[model samples]
Target: MRELLYEILTSAGRRMNFEQTARLGNALGGLLWQALPGRRKLAVEAMVRHLGISKPEAGRLAKESFRHNARSFVEIMVTQRMDPRFLAEGVTFADPERVRFLAETKRPVIFATGHLGAWELQTGSLGAFEGKRKIVVVRRPKDQALHEVMMRLRTRPMVDVVPHRQAVMPVLRILRKGGMAAFLVDHNCTRDEAVFLPFLGQTAAVNLGPALLAVRARALVVPGFLVRAEDGRYVQHFDEPLDTASLEGERDEKVQATAEFYTRAVETYVRRYPEQWFWMHKRWKTRPPEEDGQPRA
Candidate 1:
């Protein structure tokens, strides 16, 4: 049933113009926002706690976030078959010079981002802009059927997906070969193998895999995101790479510092575009082990 629905949506999305597709996404996102009462509650609470905003403001932001998220999904679907010229309309590069620096070097880079804006299209855009198929993205799907569908719709000529469970080794090899790997660093995990970091004024669990992989592979960590602008266009941002070389300490400390750097980068972007992030995610699901039997501040 999921596959059937996905096929139908993809076929319909292919024929839609930009405005029509965006409208469909807005409708769907608004509907979902209203239907998922539990998720809506969580999103609202997160906004209030993180932004320190009133409930009304949080509610408004949640609604806007839903609309943007749905539009991002449609943008992905439409871009699959749309001409690259049309898709690139109004798109800007935030810091192409930094990207050029990475591209000119033969060293591997770990591109880290959060689930903000049109993240699904980052790899493809990078490949197209740089004229290199050097990116392998890590994806964590909810189910096998959805995963297969995403692989079909999301993978571009130069971009590819690596499932989360089997991603470590493949990512290592890519890095060793002077290739890039993309990671959405804002996921919640069940494993205790994570670093505690301050996110949005709260302590959140962040995976150490990206840091560990970078350390082992001797790769530079470049953090950035593709965010929506005020005029409804997209922009590809590339920040300066994290200086892992200067981070001298125990292996555990280095790993924790690396994770914190990524988290801080994400927080910077989220603060700018508060209403364009994945507010519905349980980003703080896991608590610190030290907080056991104690109330959170």
Candidate 2:
């Protein structure tokens, strides 16, 4: 049933132009916003708490976010069916020199990204920037059937997917060998695997995996975001890389610092483009022991 729905969406998406596809997605998203009242409330409350916006404004933003998210998915479905060259052409880098330097040196890189605009395409476009280096994305959908469908959609030369549960060693190996790994770091994480940090004006549990991998592999941590342009294209923005060499202290402390650094990077972009982020997620669901009224360990 899931696969059939995916096929139906992608098949129909392929036949339409970009604008038409976006409209169809927006329509579906509008229906979703109306149907999923619980999720809609969650999104609005999050925006109100984090952005300090009024309830009405937060509701408006939440609605737009839902629409943009739907459109992003539809865009990926349509664009993935097109030629790779065409997809590459549609993405422009904010700093081409930095990208060229990374490509030329084949430096091992860890892209700390979130569920921002056109996230799938953002990660996929790395193949064009780094010619032959391995590009592995750590992702695993809960639904196995959905995972298979996404794997097929995300198929590109030199690109692979490692289940998040088993991502540690494989990602480290790839990074240690001068390859690239992209991790979507915005989702809520389990308490055991997360570090509490301030994000979007509130305390949230941030996964330490990306920073830990960077520190372990001695790779550059680059905060990457793909933002949609007025012309319907995307601009790939790469912020200054966080160098692990400068971090000093115990291994755990260094990991904590790295996690904070990347969390700030993600916050900057999300603040600038609030509607482009995935707000329906319970980003602050995991509370620290102090918040939970438990004694500190």
Candidate 3:
């Protein structure tokens, strides 16, 4: 049943009649609501209130989302990419200054991102640069089939793809060549190396990749996000660079401080659009090991 629905929706992407589209949107909402984590149920419910959907409908929508989420990450991004119209009508990407820099920069700056809103759509703005600047995105490999599709999407002249494990040197090389690389720093893969920082009033394990690279390369570390807008347009928000040269210290301290700063920015942004952020994530994966122990360093 779900596969049939996906096939129909995929086929009707830009060809659906109004009634069919409305029905799909309603189904999509149901899919999303089901996926909401218990911690994020309030956020989902709040969205229902704001959108004026019935409580029952919201609950149903959330369940559908949880189910739909089983689709490959590339599939989700592709769907979002096809609907660039979403950025114009249903989403908001909120940065003006940093986006200007991305297009006009003499050398590339690293954009460290959290899983907030429709982040992939944020690069739609970069597409305008054409040959002048290239955007390379990092992805963790899931399976061979999904990996190939992701690579295909990244093959456009304006974009590049790098696997997370093998991406570091290549990413630096991109910046070395005056192209930009976006890194997602919200997930903490190694508990020992991550620092627990405040996020949505709770401690969340945060990664420090973007900051360290910014410091090592002496390049500006910019925090930017793409958020889902009400009218379907994305508001890509680019914040001014957080200077990391100031944190001249050992590698460990530098990484930790960087984690804290980015998480704070993420927390601030999440508060502005509480429901727009990806809260279902186990952001607070690392906690103090003992009652009196300090946050993992």
lDDT for each of the candidates?
0.79, 0.80, 0.57
Worst 10 residues of 3 by lDDT: 66-75
Best by lDDT: 2
After superposition of all CA atoms, the RMSD between model 1 and the true structure is 2.1
lDDT of 1 by residue, 1-297 (tens): 878988887787778866786688789899999899998999999999999999999999999899888887877775554346744665677876886687787877888998898776675566533544455556566887777877777776656577767888778877787788888898876556688889999888898888888777878888878887777677888888986766888887878888998999999999889888999989998888888998764
Per-residue lDDT tens digits for candidate 3, residues 1-297, read 654654554554435432343355446545655554563475456446434567776555445433222222323334325343543444444554555566787666777776666554445545544455454556556666556654554455556667777766777777777677677777645566456666655565566566666666656667777664455344677787766666778977876777677777776776565444544455555664453465432
TM-score attained by model 3: 0.70
TM-score of each: 0.92, 0.91, 0.70
Which of candidates 2 and 3 reaches a greater lDDT?
2
Which candidate should be chosen as best, given TM-score against the real structure?
1
Candidate 2 deviant stretches above 4 angstroms? 8-10, 13-17, 79-84, 293-297
Q: Native-vs-model 1 lDDT?
A: 0.79
Task: Give the least accurate 10-residue stretch of model 1, judged by summed lDDT.
Answer: 127-136
How do all the candidates rank in terms of lDDT, highest first? 2, 1, 3
Q: Candidate 3: where are CA atoms >4 Å away?
A: 1-26, 32-97, 128-137, 288-297
Cα error, candidate 2, residue 126 (Å): 0.8
- RMSD, each candidate, Å? 2.1, 2.8, 6.4
